[model samples]
Target chain A: MSSHADVERRLGELLRTHEEQVISRWTQSADAPRDELTELYRAILRAIEEGGRDLADLRGLLAELSRSRARAGYSPAETSKAVFGLKGALYEIVVAHADDEVLRGFIRFARLIDDLGLFTFEAYAEAREKIIMDQAEQLLELSTPVVKLWEGIVAVPLIGTLDSARTQVVMEKLLETLVETGAEHAVIDITGVPAVDTQVAQHLLKTVFAARLMGAECVISGIRPQIAHTIVTLGIEFGDIVTKSSLADALAHAFRRSGVQVSGGPATRVTVRAEQA
Target chain B: MERVPILKLGDLLIVSIQVDLDDQTVLALKEDLAEVVVARGARGVIIDISAVEIVDSFTGRMLATIAEMCRMLDAHAVVVGMRPAVAITLVELGLSLGGVRTALNLEKGVALLDHVRGAVP
Candidate 1:
């Protein structure tokens, strides 16, 4: 049975001599590639050496390792094992040199390395959350595309919930697109929006009013039966803004405003603006 | 007194605000506009606020106040030519000019008022 003093004295030599063996023990079934494992082990040893009392020195290294693993599509279990496996390697050293003191030393080592493993997990979760949030924002931007259907008509087909942030993006993008396209008519289609409440109605109103202030006449289309019913039940007056049953209807209304008519048959007719009574 | 000019064209009052307005100027314009509307028997007021770059909370309230006054005096009020940035700012500030009608430009505003007038009686 080796004493605590004996274990401490032999720690440096034990690590240097049995480094490869310990690494081999830890990397048994871990999915971390061999090259990454080698670099990671080197970093972990340096951190434990430089940070004798605490794992503060390893914060940056662990954070980067966890984030990289997360980005590389490693599962949480795989990422966690990547750190926990190092603990196994460190334990092997304790088992070789120390006797009765081995248990005490192993306990302290486990506490420190376990904390570091937890840090890696936290970092992995944070990086994954950031990736998810960024992807969601990109999807929102992509879905809210402003399509110029005709010379003077631009349409925005809104999908998903109209949260405050999304509404701001929608309004800004629609206004900028309206200016860029020089479209006098804007069709805001809400077919993809699942529901309409007061807040959603307010967002739509704000967007329509902003477009109206920009010299473009806005017509809201894709007013599904349920959405219309919701609006009426809520007493949310969409007031003078033209509401249509579908995008085609809105487009028809826009064409009519520009003095053009759309018919179901192939034959179409253009009405002069002079017919306005 | 730096008052926003109010030009009476027939029964319509056209207010083209071409200068940056201080609080005092805005207040004076309000009083002057109300008096002119009453005196000239104006049926509609088209306020062109295109030149004013920013409509902070105070300016936005002033607009709402002017529109409310027009309503009380039986005159229709239309705010025209509000810049895109200004509109965005107003919406962000959460000050919706609920009582005021808006148009893209002065011409459209006047046309809107005429349409309203024709529809009313």
Candidate 2:
């Protein structure tokens, strides 16, 4: 029976060896092509699959392997791809043994994988920090934006700050969803956002512009006072983006914009004249 | 482009919120709006949100807080123009508006705000 500490030591050694192999594979003369690097990844997975592996030991081994891979001239672009591939593999393993406690370790391992893969890349430190600064930009989360219908209208409730990266994701996803669902108007409620800097504000403007480009009207709701003040101070204009106080207000606005009216209610309308930029 | 202005209709103020409500301009407007509501004795408020793409929990909580503060100052708050995707995420993350009124656009929201105010009597 191998002691737990022994297993840990062995796992560390394995990781160190894996690291060395990765480094050596990359540093080796291209004149002598080494296709074995790919094979090594497979071998590592196979080793993990065979028998009751200790979590600590496996982590140790994998850590060293990742370090070696980084040491071996792994370019940043390649690093991102590798991270994705590793994530796929880890996802498979976690899904395969969903309820197993021992597999819990693998799930934890999966979460840490991004830290190892992305942060370790000896690339632009500023770019890395920027990507990690906002949770919206972290592509690690698995979420597909979808349109939901309520009372014959489409509503898209925004729940996070719009960073440039996330803005791109939202724009792409919203456009795709809008076209797919044939939503004529989109209501975007932003009562949840805390603060808006100039760049973040610009990113939202771009989204509104993108929505119009897709032949859909976008409505903005949830104007907290702090946000209102910032907009005035920064002099950022939202001439084209339609905004309201709440989702209900947006729906009413949409009804008026589409010329649809609910029966037996007091009709209220506000004429909005966009100030010239 | 000039920033979206706060449009007042009757006792309610219609604020069209852009996507970048987290920026400095919006931040400054918060205090200004709060003061205006308190001083003006506005009975209702409607904030339009058709332009936003993201609204994290921090911002979401702030809006809820704003609604609470508005009520204390004798104004009812309503949020509108929420995108479906963002709504899904906010729900998944377990965020609530804490009883703030919501609408789809400025027109319907204003109507509802008026209704809510009328009903309050």
Which predicted model would earn the best TM-score? 1
**Model 2 agreement with the true structure over A183-248: per-residue lDDT tens digits:** 657777777667778887766666665555334577888877888899889998888678887777
Residue A270 miss distance in model 1 (angstroms): 10
lDDT of 2: 0.61
In CAPRI terms, model 1 is classed as acceptable
lDDT of 1 by residue, B1-121 (tens): 6777899898999999988878888899899999999999999999999898877788889999999999899999998887778888887788767778887678778888998999996
Cα lDDT tens digits, model 1, A1-277, are 7755554445545566777887787777566767767766766556545545555547777788787777788877778777788777677677667766556656655776788788888887888789899999888778778889998789999988888788888888888876566677999999999998899899899988778766678999999898889899999988888999999889888998977766555355655677657
TM values, all candidates: 0.72, 0.35
Q: What share of the true interface contacts does each candidate keep?
A: 0.40, 0.00
Please give the distance, in angstroms, between residue A234's alpha carbon in candidate 2 and its true position after superposition: 1.2
TM-score, first chain, each model: 0.78, 0.46
